[model samples]
Target: MDSFDAIVVGSGFGGSVTAYRLAEAGLRVCLLERGKAYPPGSFPRSPHETAKNFWDPSSQLFGMYDLWSFSKLDALVSSGLGGGSLIYANVLIRKPETWFVNESIDGGYERWPVTREDLDPHYDSVERMLDAQPYPFDQKPYEDTPKTVAMQEAAGKLGLSWELPKLAITFARPNEAPAPGVEIPGGDDNLHHSPRSTCRLVGECDLGCNFGSKNSLDLTYLSAAQRRGADIRTFCEVRAFEPVDGGFQVSYIEHRPGQDGDPAAPPLRGAVRARRLILSAGALGTPYLLLRNRSAFPALSPALGSRFSGNGDFLGMIVKARRLQEEGGDGELVPRLLAPSYGPVVTSAMFMPDAHDEGGTGRGFYIEDAGYPEFLNWLVENNVLTMSHRVGRFLLRRAWSAATHSPKSQVGRSAADALSKGLFTATSLPMLGMGRDVPDGRVFLREGHLDLDWDLTASKPYFDRLNKTMGEVSKSLGGRYWASPLWLLNRLITVHPLGGAPMGRDRREGVVDSYGQVYGYPGLSIADGSVMPGPVGPNPSLTIAALADRSAERIIDDHRRNPAGRP
Candidate 1:
């Protein structure tokens, strides 16, 4: 059996950062992932190819961003070596300072044990590694689609703070060809050999960066950690952990592909030994893993599954002009408009903290632009239009067939085709609102599977506030408020789920301590979204990385002080 100084599970922001830091400190680290390593060219970009993209149902159950079909809520997430980063819009954002934790708020829980001050340095470190930078260009040509630029203009009028978003995309330089694979220190052998390429701005990042410009964990930290001598094994799903004499017995399964590379194969089980265990399986996966290992830690805090919250996220579509000529535009392609599908999913954000003051009906939510891949157009045409009584079922069926069968060649032929075309020409923008959600959700183990019992009724105030702000921005941009009625009918969707297994002074109030160490276990630790004690009020990726870095440093310091295990 192979053993290491540390074993990090999941290769997302948290796991990757922890692995890199530990490996840099001369600790032998094994990073285990339940999915295959997605190379630059391996991603499917075309609409037809994207439909076939599916995550393992079993593994998806444990992922933060897994596509979930529950009796309660509709959720979507990804599973792979890079985890959700493989499919997420690379928006690197910092949580607002006020979002740390405030007990003054009604129904608020205890304050976050580790404040902004304790995480500043780690945030700085993560930003540098990911090459976080602001949008390069100031002016966009799309006038009909007023996304970030329009939001900023509206926020300025409202006397609110709006800023260009920090992105993780690498654009091409003049006279430079796309670099697909380039070597970087501490990168994986494949990624190190893979060249770095420029982004084509094909607006297909959400599907996967086939162009290789988006710096996801697989291309950044995970790759770097591999180069630093950390052993990363993919398609290895961890089942549970058992406490051993001086370490832990880690059990996992090897996944195989079915015919034509479909996800239809029996899993082969195996086990390994590790001295130190780091759980970075994300909020959903980590909790699931712990539930599976419940027998090992029966005395864990009852708070292990409490205080769960999603960074209240909402999506709305805004279209300024129905056609290029509708909004006083020249030529077939609209100019002076910022299309939501042009660049990173989120390139700018507007903060509205005061929107919730004075017993306001709303809460803090930032309105940014959301970019969708071409595949979503099909979904919009089939699902969104079919709901309209005007479109007959006979016509809708034909449209669905045409949209799905001939996606690439027959691109501009469906109901959504015209809108998508206009969008491509910068006539539309998808507005996104993210805020702190009420932490009324509960995480628990049922039949050894992680379960989430979340309700949005308590989040009515926050959503109301978000809608008001969004409406204001829409009117200012001379655009109409557009969104999937599904959101209104079934609440909203969230990509950043946080606050489970939070940190506190004792197990009575939290699962882990300020440093992310399990209260009863000496070497066991958590360095992921599971430890985020409260709503981050922003994209949780960067914050999760920062927290992991800080936790790893503390763990290393403690390990150095007491080489032998001590509680």
Candidate 2:
């Protein structure tokens, strides 16, 4: 079996960052990613393609989206060489300085062994690597993005702080003016070996950026790691690992594309040895792997599956928002063109600072304008009776004019009006909420499968506060508000699941130490959201990468001190 100095599992923010750092540090590194790599323009969008766009190993459907359902929550994550970065909205906000609550909440307390100050330099390093930049809303064409404007107006009315958060996207080449929907530079040199284009304002970031504008891991860390001589394998799913005499032995299944279609095809098994192992398979995956491979490490922390949280993610919508132009006007209510599907998945963010500040109650959360694809606009237009009415009226008028007037009577003007009139889709916005909620949820193995024991009863107040704030924002924008569909059933959905293996001062509190090393297992570390002791009060991707950067430094120092890889 091939052996290496370090092996990192799952190429998300954590795994990719670790791979790049270790490779740069001159370590013999290997990265294992279960999903296939998605080069530019490979993400599927058509109905037939999307129909099969799910992660199901039984049917051999290996797609990007991986959905999981628990008793209290539904989770959506990505499955690809780039991991969640391929499907994330590209927000790269740092964890708030004061929002790191180390005290107890309703259900359970949150404590972080590493503070914001400890991660400042690491955050800078990650930001530079990802090429983070704020959405250039001040530019001409982007200045009037309706959803962004509407969000800012609502925040101003509500007396909240609103600003454009940094995003991992390439809007223009170096020293060039910002332009959308144009050919991007540096495509030939990218790892994917595919041409890419600038962001076209398609709101398809969550669907995977086919244009390669988003600086996802595949374009950044993974590519850098490969260039630095890291061995990367895709479609190789790690089943389990155990510490051997001097190193760890990993067993995995090597999946072949055509082989999956044949029932009689035997499974291809593979194994490798590594002096050091890093688990970056994300919060749920890492914990599940450890729980299933529990016998391998009997001295693993008791907090293996403890401190689970959804990062207080809540989804809501603001529909039929009135334009600021409608204010103080005597004419009919002019619906604002929020046009939620016109820009990136997220463009601007409004922060609700935590109660640590005076005159605040529970923990604070962030609300951003969420977006979808323009195809969804057709569905939105079809759902509204007024829109159909306008189209129907225009068609009837066109038919009458053709019959009464010239045979070549013009319908172009009326058709344009019909297509544009009463379009409610242009006036809707999706509200994405995330912040600190109680981290009381627990993960455990049930009948040899991973299961979650979580309830919203204890965190009801926090969610209620979030919903009430969203309701107020909707009212301020003259729109109707609605929570997620699952909310009525007391269930929540989260894309940013955090904390299954958390960091602490010692084994009693966390599965890993401040440096993300397993307490009893030297040379074994976790550099993912699973190691978050508490919820990061923003998009957790940046923080996860920063933590991984820090963890990689520790691993490098340890390796340097003991060249033989002894702990």
Candidate 3:
């Protein structure tokens, strides 16, 4: 069995940062990622390819999306070399200073043991490593991106706090004008040895940027970790771990091609010993793993499965937005020229004050312009953009030309116009809102599988506020808002699932402590969204990375003070 100074599970915002920091400190670290590595241009695009993109080992399907459809809510998280960063929208907003609540929230979730001040230095360190930058909206071509302009205009008219949030995307090299398809200069080539480019305004950030414009974790922290000689093995899924005399013993399965998921044939497992084990398998993953392997850690905290939240995620779509014309009635409406399929997935964010804070209302939230991929526009257009009518009109015109024996040179032009940028898809916009929500959700193993017992009842008031505000934003844009179908059923999906092995002041309060050390276990730590005591009231990725960086400092200091059992 192979061994190391530390074994970090799941190369996410947390795992990647920890691996890099530890490797830099000259500690032997091994990172285990369950999903395959996605270099630039490897993400699926066609419907056929996308249909097979899911993470189900039993079905021999190891893809990016690892979905957990619990009774009340569905959670979508990534399982890849870079984890959620591969699928995220690349927004890097920090948790609000006031939101690092020193007291427990309404639903008995633990108070945050660490605060913004504690994470400030770590936040700066992670930002520098990821090369975070705001969308260059002030620049020429970027400024004219329709969704960005439209979002800004609507926020200004509605008195919402609007600003371009920082993105972990390389819009340009340092001190260079924003240009599409330009090579990004970096200290180390990404793990795949592929070249990265600046943002190409392709609206593919959430779908994995083929141009590598998004400064994803694989391209940044994980790359640096590799350079520092950290052993990074993808397609290695850890299944069990237990504390040992000197450290911990870990067991994992290696997923390879051509392996049949047969009932009779069990998977071949491997084991390793590490001086320390840091679990960074994300909010959904880490909790599920711990709950499933509870028998191994007999003295784990009672709060292991508590303090779960979706970070107040709410999705609502707005349609039929009007563009004010020179001559129109008091309430005339025209489809706006905002193309939602042109820029990165998210550009501008509108901030609403929280009741806990001095500014205003109920639990605070953020509404950002959630752009879609160019291909999704076609799906939207075909579903709701009068496709039948357009096809009928085209056939009629072509039939008329043929019957009249006319030279119809303009037929191709009409076909192109019908397929490109229809008003319905151009004006339709998805507003993504997330913030503080009641964190009373629980996760536990049922029949040896992970499940969550949570609902919208406790968080109803917070979501109501979010809905009302989304409705106002829609009306301001000359449209009506429709809640997502799932939301109508009081169910919501969250990419930012947080708090399962949450941190607290003591074992009675949480599973982990302020430095991410597991409360009862000495060398075991959790450095992911699973450590969040409550909702971060922001995108949460940056905060997760920052918290991991802070934890890494403690780990390095302890290692220096007491050299462990090593070769």
The candidate scoring highest on lDDT is 2
Per-residue lDDT tens digits of candidate 1, residues 230-305? 9999878898897787778789988775655555567788787777899988877788788778889888888887
Provide TM-scores for the models.
Answer: 0.83, 0.94, 0.95
Descending-TM-score candidate ranking: 3, 2, 1
RMSD of each: 6.8, 2.7, 2.6
Which candidate model has the greater lDDT, 1 or 3?
3
Worst 10 residues of 2 by lDDT: 258-267
Clash pairs, model 3 backbone: none
Off by over 4 Å in 3: 186-188, 259-267, 327-332, 383-389, 404-421
Candidate 2 matches the true fold with a TM-score of 0.94
Select the stronger candidate by lDDT from 1 and 2: 2
Error of 2 at 138 (Å): 1.0
Model 1 stretches with alpha carbons more than 4 Å out: 46-48, 57-65, 104-106, 139-146, 172-192, 259-265, 321-338, 354-362, 374-426, 564-567
Whole-model lDDT per candidate: 0.71, 0.88, 0.87
TM-score for candidate 3? 0.95
